[model samples]
Target: MTGNRFVTQALGEYTLAGLANCSAEIVKTARPVNLNLFSIKWPVTALVSIAHRISGVLLFLAMPLLLYLFELSLSSEAGFRRAGAMLASPMPRLVGWLLAVALLYHLIAGCRHLLMDMGFGETWRGGKAGARTVIAISVLGAILAGILLW
Candidate 1:
């Protein structure tokens, strides 16, 4: 009674003090850490994956801005010219180039999704082939964009 002043319910594993000690041990032994690439150079497939995610994020975030510009353009003629002048700027042109690339990536990835939906790229080999296709298409789109923009 002198040492054990408190007890949990009848079916319990630990008192509050016991739980605190257990948690401290767990924290010391099981601290979370990031999976840093210690010695490996980045792989092409990983780059492609990161690019895909970036393109997706860019498209999602740009959608709102693009929609707002559209709304502003429709509000009045001055609004239309303002939006037009913004697009005509060097910075906006660069952003447009980025958006175009993202759109191309999204389109190619969406086509891959459609193919998978249709049961085309199901197996590991098929998935690899589809990834190859994405790489090819993404490169092709870049070439096309370069030609168009230049």
Candidate 2:
């Protein structure tokens, strides 16, 4: 009923639960828990999530450089040759390779996140394994990209 105190209190508690980053135990006991994201004791799942965020940011930052290169390569024969020469340099090659690695990592991590949303890797063990798998695939893809780039 609109005048029910218990219903209002329950709704408030649920809203607070959704807002806080506390664990289930903290929620059940209604106690505040101090969490440090930079702690060394973070699990693989946390590491994977952090890496995913980092890679996404890296990709965002690289977009401008990629677009500039694309424009240079498409403008004219001289512009295309200049773009090729720039890419042939060591520093540009390294940066391109790193961006490629970031893309691969982001893509694989995205797939993992999608699977997680579909109810896969929802358990503790599954989450850990999925993190490891994502890391492994990213490393392999980066190495392969490096080889191909050079």
Candidate 3:
């Protein structure tokens, strides 16, 4: 049989062929739709998961700036002084603090994920508690990072 005829004959053999046609409409109505992000009340576990993803993006975006600074500092004596001065500025210090905090949070969240993979904190209650602990540790780390950065 030709490809189209074969497909048609196979589809004619099952109820799923009819379902395939209406699948889009069925999916649209079968699931709960919430497009407004602000209107939803997010749980701690969800928030932490989102934050973990965002921190990963932030870290990826920061790589170029960090690499440039590293290259500049190693180029020459003058370049090293320039890099140091740039870091000493308020904006660079703030960026450094943010980077540090993001790193700390990402690290803690990653550890949580690793533990979950190992079958720890896989339950709803345990996951929530783990998320809260991650946030608490991140906050404390952020404060310490700010203190040390400035």
Candidate 4:
């Protein structure tokens, strides 16, 4: 028999009412939509971890601005003064502080990853402890820098 005619005959037999959807065991599926409810507990450690990654990305994107500043400082003593003076502006100072913190976090995280690669933090507990150490170091460095800056 022709393929078209066979398909038509098959459809005529198992169709539900007028339409052709009579296959057994229809499956249902869904993706979890996270609605921020008050009942949900936000993890501080997770947030800090995400912020570390975001800061890394911010640092990467700010490379051009940083390079410009660096070049300006190295160009001449007058250029150094001008670049230094730019940091005196509140916005630039704030950005500089953020960049410093990002640098600290990146450095600490890199060390942690390096240790992990050396088979130090291979287990679950080891990883968590390493993360905590990174946080502590980053926080202490940031606090020290902040105190000095402010």
Candidate 5:
């Protein structure tokens, strides 16, 4: 029966008994959330979340280009050579590196999310640490991809 204290207060002319449980119900006024894109500094966890979403979208949009390249490389010998030559150029190489980096980041972030969903790294400190680890690994993988691309 241990619970909140009942504080009786006056409302009008009638004297009420101790019936109001003010301590039981704590209400906080909600503040208006400002979502100005450039006004707020995001934390590491938020940055990782945003990058995860962006990387996923980038991979989805690059699917058509990847499919086209696959089809071109398999169509004919000349087409295969053309595809190879196209990939050899600087612009295409850069784009390929970017796609590779995005894919790596998305994959790592997805694994982190899965682990969190499975009850791992569920605490606030653990979540932030996991996010930092994901970012560090993704950056290292991206650097290796860039080195390979060049």
Candidate 6:
């Protein structure tokens, strides 16, 4: 076996030495590292992209709670009433509205991404416009969801 070579019984063969060398070389390169996120002025398109990811994560995290409430609502008549009452409270209503807004934003951003995949909004100008449009539509959807929920 060579100094840079390693063998794994399950994986057959692998080499970490090359990866280590490559990372070391990368570290030696002079690159500007901005650790302060707040100091950077992010573009609208970048902000929208970040928000899209955040909304997706929020939706994923809320899924279990949503499914539990749904199951409770469908379990029995009393369970249905209890679930309704629980959702009727201020905090639950606020959470539900927030989830609704996140869902709406995610859906809108997803549509924008699909459009981009289809060759639309590939340019800088187009991407910025699409991001603005997504924000506008999401805001409108949030207002509508709030009205319906409240």
Q: Which candidate leads the pack in TM-score?
A: 6
> lDDT of each prediction vs. the true structure?
0.68, 0.78, 0.80, 0.70, 0.74, 0.76
Across 53-82, the per-residue lDDT of candidate 5 in tens digits comes to: 999999999999999999999999998999
Q: Which candidate has the top score in lDDT? A: 3
Put down candidate 4 lDDT per residue, 21-100, tens digits, no spaces. Answer: 43333412222233332433333334445666898998999999999999999999999999999978888888899999
- Model 1 is weakest, by summed lDDT over 10 consecutive residues, at 2-11
User: Which segments of model 5 are wrong by more than 4 Å?
Assistant: 1-34
* Clashes, model 3: 0
**What is the alpha-carbon RMSD of candidate 5 to the true structure?**
11.5
Query: If ranked by TM-score, best first, what sequence of candidates would result?
Result: 6, 3, 5, 2, 4, 1
Against the true structure, candidate 1 has what lDDT?
0.68
* TM-score, predicted candidate 4 vs. hidden true structure: 0.69
Candidate 3 Cα lDDT to native:
0.80
RMSD of 2: 9.8
- Backbone clashes for every candidate come to 0, 0, 0, 0, 0, 0
> TM per model?
0.61, 0.73, 0.74, 0.69, 0.73, 0.76
**What TM-score would you give candidate 5 relative to the actual structure?**
0.73
User: Residue-wise lDDT of candidate 3 within 45-139, one digit each (tens)?
Assistant: 77898899999999999999989999999999999999988878898888988888999999999999999889898877788899999999999
Q: Order the candidates by lDDT, highest first — what do you get?
A: 3, 2, 6, 5, 4, 1
**Taking the tens digit of each residue's C-alpha lDDT, what string does model 6 give over 1-150?**
111111121112222333354666674663224324454446677688789899899999999999999999999999899998986788999998999999889999899889988999877778889989999999999999888877
Task: Say which prediction, candidate 1 or candidate 2, comes out ahead on TM-score.
Answer: 2
lDDT for residue 68 in candidate 2, whole number 0-100: 95
